[model samples]
Structures are given as structure tokens and as C-alpha cells.
Target chain A: MNLFQYVRPAEQKTAIAAVAAEPTARFLGGGTNLLDLMKRHIMQPEKLVDVTRLPLKGITQQGNIIRIGALTRNTEIAEDKTILQNLPLLAMAINAGASAQIRNMATTGGNLLQRTRCPYFYDTAMPCNKREPGTGCGALEGFNRMHAIFGFSDKCIAVNPSDMNVALRALDATVVVNGPKGERKIPIADFHRLPGDTPEKDTNLDKNELITAVTIPISPFSKNAYYLKVRDRNSYAFALVSVAAALNMDGNTIKEARLAMGGVAHKPWRLTDAETFLKSKTATEENFQQAAQIAFQGAKAFKHNQYKLKLGPNTIVQALSVASGLKSV
Target chain B: MNEQEPFCPNESRRSFLKKSTVITAVALTPAAAINAANNHWDEHIAAAIENVSLSVEINGTRHTMDIDPRTSLLDLLRENLHLTGTKKGCDYGQCGACTVHVNGERVLSCLTLAATTDGSKVTTIEGLANGDELHPMQAAFIKHDGFQCGYCTPGQIMSAVACIREGHASSRDQIREYMSGNICRCGAYPNIVDAIEEVQKGGQKV
Candidate 1:
């Protein structure tokens, strides 16, 4: 890692100003991903503004709404009583994402901002458009079994590796960020952007903006929600095709459904069409299969990931079955 | 102690400190060990090394040192303080061989910046034993034969102790899930689970 200047600003405005002053400056949260990137010489920042010591480190509730500080560690969010009781899908997704050690050290904002686990992106020897624009995407023709199947442009096909972001997207969370211009609220859907021409930009966040907290509402789908992560290993592995399925059931019928998928798109792929199809339908395997089919309508698989076409629908069906309590979790 | 001169090479000093610190690290506080590192050294090894002031307590010994802003906690423990008990496996947080307790929570020291650990209490494998008496978790590992090569033992033991304390060791599955951070290339997972169970059975000892 390059020797850089470190600053721990006590105030939020100071932190924002510090990053804005230096074009190569970055806000360091837990430094799990940033430090690793620095070690590999992927990201060389001149100044790192440590945000861990700031006053953004807790989970608060107002009535039925919960506000999670961006600095709140993933372990704390997973183990929080209110989160477990109200938004259980978020907790389950957080647990299914990374190992206990990483979850213990990684923060909420850092997890959302984590780079993709694409091998080409990590290997500096390879040509990665995300790492360096106009370098050509190596993952396009290389080993792309883990690449994206939705919302992918020709520039890049890397999928977002954040389980927390998928759950947040499914839960209808809003991200609150502070910048030099002013504080603004960004909906969870718009927080992360697809890889258009600028594959370097992962989210819609400005370089000067600092993520403060995320707000998730206590929805009716809390009672029946499940995060099903399909991976090579049972634990500590990135998702192959995971689903965050939640259902608001009215007896044997579904009142509403919230569905978002990970490891299949540039961003969290929210299955809004499948969700609409599942509304008012009886909780059955046939209906779930139809909904899964609807979710995969435009999903196009790469050369090595043809199996995802089959596995994706199966996972969606299984996750829906588990969320509606038709199958045991 | 002049590092720029030809007489005081870093290797000889490091070897002497390693040989001499076997007793001082345990018999006395390891503050002197770091002091020896500070008193005889060259901080200007590279042009990029901008020394940052950091005050951290490791193994119950408080030591203030001027470290490079790029220095990781694992590098500081092994290279500066000569605390090599915490092994470096992958060094990129992929392997948990650098596991240590930061503020009583199990974290990958390789990923943690030493400068960020200011005013924080860190515990390594060297601090698990009390005098000659081994910690209950350490003893349980031996009794259950939790390791074969012992390369990943330190990280596994540290993570195991934390798993039991965090109330995540209630069942064998829970132990496996919580201890998933530590990877044993030797595949001693079943025995490690047994060791954790024994330590969990014997309450308030870890």
C-alpha cells in the first residue's frame, strides 16, 4: 500500500470538505475493501478521511421506521433486536454475505460501496474496463460464470457482490447522504447504477458525498421473509444466484410480494413484475414457478453461466416457497 | 542503534530482539519489546513512509509508536513488535490466519490498519496464556486435537474463544457458522468444533 495521509475529522462537514478538497481523497469507513485495494495498488488515494470514529454508529427507531447509521457494523445490524424482529430479511442477508470476521469489521455504508468480486477486476495484469476505462473487459470473454445476467452494458458485466444492498433494495430503504451542496435522500433503487459507459462509477453517489445513514420501514412483509443464498459453499462464499423474497400474506393468498435478486445483475435486480404477478394469487408452487419465469424474462446468460438460467428460476421458486412458509427454511 | 550506518543492520537487531523477547514478552510487559524496536530503528526506509503517531495497547501493554500510515496491524504485530504468533496466511482477509481480538471483537488484523487502532486494546495469541497456565480454550484445543500443522491454530483459537463468548457456540452448527471466518487448510474443522464445544461446556473460563 502507498503511504498516504490519514485524517479523522470529528464533524461531518469537515469530512465532506476534506474529500472534496483532494481529488484523490477517499472516505475510509472500516477499510476492509479499501485497504485491500490499496495493498494491491488498485486504488491509490492521497488522503484517507477515517469516518469510523464519527458519531454515525448506531441503530435508532422512530415509531415503525428504523434508521441504521452507515458506520454501523454488519454484525451489529444482523444482531440488532429491532432489525431481527422487523426486517428479518435484512439480517439474514447480512449473515449470508460474508464471514463473521468480515461482518464484524465491515460497516453498512462500506458494504454497499464494496467493489465487485470479479476476478478480472482484481488482477491488474488483465484488461478490465471497470478498473481502467477503454482497457477492454476481460471478464467478457474470460471465465465469466460469475458475471452478470441483467442490467449489464457492453462495457462491463460484473455483478454487485453486496447481500446487504439486495435486502435493502427489497425492503424499500432510503439512503441519506451529505455533500458540499447539501443533504439529500436517495432511494435504494437509484443508489446503485448499472455499468453504462462509466463502469468505474459503481453508485450514483458523488465523489464529495458522504453516506450518513439508511432508513428502512417496517413493512407488512416482515413476518414472512427469507434470504436464500445459493453458492458453491454453504458459508463465506459469494452468491451464485441469491434471492431476497418477502411476502405479505392474506390467509392462503398473497397480498403483496417483495423480490430482489443478487449475483445476477449489475445492481440488485428487483423483480417488480414477478412481485406484481404474485399479488392476490394463492401461495402455490405453480404460481411461484410462473412468477420465477416472469422474473427471468429478460435475463441473458453468458457463455459459462448458462446454468444460471435454470438455477435462477429454481432459486426464485424455492425462495418464494420458503418466504410464504410453504417450505421449511 | 544508528540505522543509516553499516554496523546496525535491521536483521541482526530483529533476530536479537526475537531471541531476547521470548522471556520479556511474557515475564514482563511487551512495552519494552516495542520500546527496543523504537529505540533502535530507521523509520525512513522508504520515501513514502510518513510516520503517524499511534497509541495502542496490545496484550495488556501500552506502547506509543510512530508507524507508517500504510502499516497493517498484522505487520505491526509480526514485524515491529515481533509478535509472530499471529500468522499471515492470505494477507488479504481471504484467509483468517491473521485473526486477533480488537476491542474484544474478532477481526482480521491484516485488513485493520495499525494507525486506525489508536487507543484500542488488541489481544493476540501471545496474550491468551496466563503465565505458564494455558487458557481454557487453548487447553481444549490440545485435548480435542483441534489442529494438525498448527499454522492456522492461533487465528482459529482466537476466533473460537470469541465464538463462545459471543453466545454463538450453543450448537455444533452455530460453532461452525461462527467459526467460518478461520480456515484450516489442514481440514481440522470437526476437531476444532469439538474443541469449541468443550470450551463452551466449561463456562466462564475463556
Candidate 2:
């Protein structure tokens, strides 16, 4: 990593001002992703405003929403009694994403802002539009087993490899960001952007905005939610196809449902159509299969990811089945 | 302007004033001043001027040192403090060979910048023993043959201790899940899990 100036601002205002004043400066939270990117020379910030000590680490519950500070470590959130009880899906998704060591070092904001794990993007020598705009996507014609299957443009086919973000989208979380222009709350659905002409930008956040907290509204599906991540390995691997399924059941019928998928799109692909189709339907294998089919209506696969067309639906059905208490695996 | 003199006084004074003006501008912005000093000056001088002083307690020893802001906790331990017990397998956060405890939580040292860990208590494998007595996890590792080549033993023991302390070592599957970060190349996972289970069941203070 290149030698850079580090300033740990004790105040949030100071940290926001530092980032706003310097375009090349970045806020250092847990240093899990940023430092790794820096070591690979993928990102080279001239200055790092250390925001780790800026009073942004807490997990609180208000009347109908749970506010989680952005700097809260993944392990803390995953193990917090309130989060585990209130948002079990979030906890399960976080635990499934990384290992214990990484979970200890990775923060909530950093995890949401993590870069794609595409090999082409990490190579730095390869031609990746996500890494360098207008350079052309290497995965479009190269090895793309881990590329996206939905919401992918010809310019880029990378997927957001975050399990937590998938659950947050399903829970309808809101991201609170502090910037030079004061504060703004962005819905989790609109937080991450699809890789269109500009694959270089992964999020809807501005360069100067610093994420302070994420608030998740209380949902009735907390009792019937599951985060199923399928990977090549049993643990410590990014998901090949993951599903976040939550159902609000009235007796044996689904009253409401929220579904989102990861490792299949540039952002957390929310299955609004599938969610609508599952409502008022009996929680059964057939209904889940139909919903899964609806979820993959527009999914397009790449050269080496055709199996996702099959695996994605299978995983969704299994997740829905397990989440609705119809079956357990 | 005496061209033959090779040093025009007017041009020299003008360049000096321009350089001074730039320096004055840099000085006004401390962040820019630090970057300017790092880029335009000698690296050693830049490091000396830009490196932040960190007073950290590691392995029960309190030491004060100056380190580059970019220096990782792993590099600071191995390179600066010469604590090689904490190995650096990947230098990234993937491998858990550089695992250590900061405030009693097992974190990837390579992913932690030393400058960010100011005033925090750090504990490495070297600090796991009570002088002559080995930590319970270390002893259990030997009893259960938890490793082959032992390159990942220290990290495994450190994580095992934390896994038990964190209440994630209740079952074999739980131990395996929590200890997934520390990879053993020789496939000593079965024994590692056995060792962790024994340590957990023994009710010994880790």
C-alpha cells in the first residue's frame, strides 16, 4: 500500500468536512475492504479520514424501526441480542457471508460498500469496465462463472457479493448518510445501482457522503425468514447463488412476502413480481416453484453461469419452503 | 540578464518566489501540506514528518513508536515489533494466519491499520502463555494433534480460544463454522475441532 496521510477525526462533522474538502480522501471504517483494495493498488486514496472512532457504533431499536450504526462490526451486529431477535435474517445473512475474523474486522457501512469479487476486476491488468470505464468488460467474453444473471448490461456483468445487503433490501432498510449538504436517507432498494453504461459507480452514494446508520423497519416476517447461500465451499466463500426469503403467513397462507437475491445482479435483485405472486397463496412447493419462476423471468446467463438459471430457482424454492415452515433443511 | 552566467538573477528570484508561494499554500492546508511533503520530499523525510505516533499495548508490553499510516497491524507486529508469531499468510483478510486479539476480539491483523489501533490493547500468540504455562488451547492442540506442519497453529489456537469465549464452540459443527477462517492446509480440521471441543468441555479458563 502506498504511504498516505491518516487523520482520525474525533467528530463526525470533522470527518465529513475532511472527505468533502478532498476528492481523493476516503473514510476509513474497519479497513477490511479499503485496505485490501489499497494493497492491490485497485484504489489509492491520498488521504484516509479515520472514522472508526467517530461515535457511529451502536444498535438501537425505536418504536417501529431498528437503527444500526454504520461502523458496527459485522460480528457485533450478528451477535447482538436485539438484532438476532428482531432481524434474524440479517444476522443469518451476515454470518453466512464471511468468516469470524473478517466479520470481526468488517463494518456495516464497509460491507454495504464492498466491491465486487469479480476476478477480472481484481486482476487490474485485465480490461474491466467496472474497474476502468470504456475499457470493455473482460467477463463478457472471458471466464464469467461468477458474473451476474440479472440487471446486467453489455458494458458490465458483475454482481454485488454482499449477503447482508440482500437481506437489508428485503427488510426495506434505509441508509442515513451525512455529507456537506447535511443528511439524507436513501431507501435500501435504491442504494445500489445496476451496472448500466456506468459500471464504475457501484452505489447511488456521492463521493462526499458518509454513511452513518441503517434503519430497518419492523416486519412480521421476522419469524419466518431465511437466508440461504449456496457456494462452492461450505463456508468462507462468496455465494454462487443466494436467496433471502421472508414470508408473513396467516395460518397456512402467505399474507405478504419479500424476496431478494444476491450474486445474480449488479445490486440486490428484489423480486417484486415474485413477492406479489406469493401473497395470498398457500405456502407449498408448487406455489414456491411458481414464485421462483416469476423471480427469474428476465434473468440472463453468461457463458459459464447457465447453471444459475436452474440453481437460482431451486435455491429460491428451498429458501421459501424453509422460511415458511413448510419444510426444513 | 547575463545569459553567460548560467543563472539569471531575475528568473531565479521569480522561481523562488513561485515555489515559496506554493509552499505557503500547502502550509495553509495541513492535509495538502502532508501530501506535498510526502510526494515532493525524500521518502524518509516524508515518513518521518507524516508518520503518526502510536502508543499501543501488545503482549503486556507498552511501546511507543512512529509508523506509516498505511502500515498494517500485521506488518507492524512482524516488521516493527518483531512479533513473528503472528504470521502473514495472505497479507489480505482472506487467510486467518494473521489473527490476533484487539480488545479481546479476534480480528484480521492484516486488515487493521496500526495507526487506527492507537491506545488499544493487542494480544498475539506470544501473549497466550502465563510465563511457563501454556494456554489451555495450546495444550489441547498438542494433546489432540491439531496440526501437521503447524504454520496455522497459532492462529487456530487464538481463534479457538475466542470461539469458546464467544460461545460459538458448543458443537462440532459450530466449531467448524466459527473456525472456518483459519485454514489448515494439511487437513487437520478434524483434530482441530477435536482440540477445540476438548478445551471447551474442559471448562478451563482460556
For residues A249-285, write the lDDT of model 1, one tens digit per residue: 9998999999999999989989999999999999999
Q: Whole-model Cα lDDT per candidate?
A: 0.88, 0.87
**After superposition, candidate 1 runs with Cα above 4 Å error:** B1-49
lDDT of 2 by residue, A55-125 (tens): 78889999989999999999999989998888999999999988998998888999999986589988888
TM-score of each: 0.91, 0.94
Docking level of model 1: acceptable
Chain B TM-score of model 2, please?
A: 0.82
**Tens digit of lDDT per residue, candidate 2, span B1-206?**
01111100133433453466444544434345456554764454445445677778999898888777778999999999899999888888887988999989999999999987788889999999999899999999999999999998888889999999999999999999999999888999999999999989999988
Angstrom error at residue B14, model 1: 31
**lDDT for each residue of candidate 1 in B1-206, tens digit (9 for 90 to 100):** 01111111134444454466343343322223323333443223221123566788999999898777778999999999999999999999988999999999999999998978888899999999999999998998999899999999999999998898889999999998898888999999999999999889878568
In the order shown, what is each candidate's alpha-carbon RMSD? 9.2, 7.8
True contacts kept of each: 0.57, 0.63
Worst lDDT run of 10 residues, candidate 2 chain A, spans: A1-10
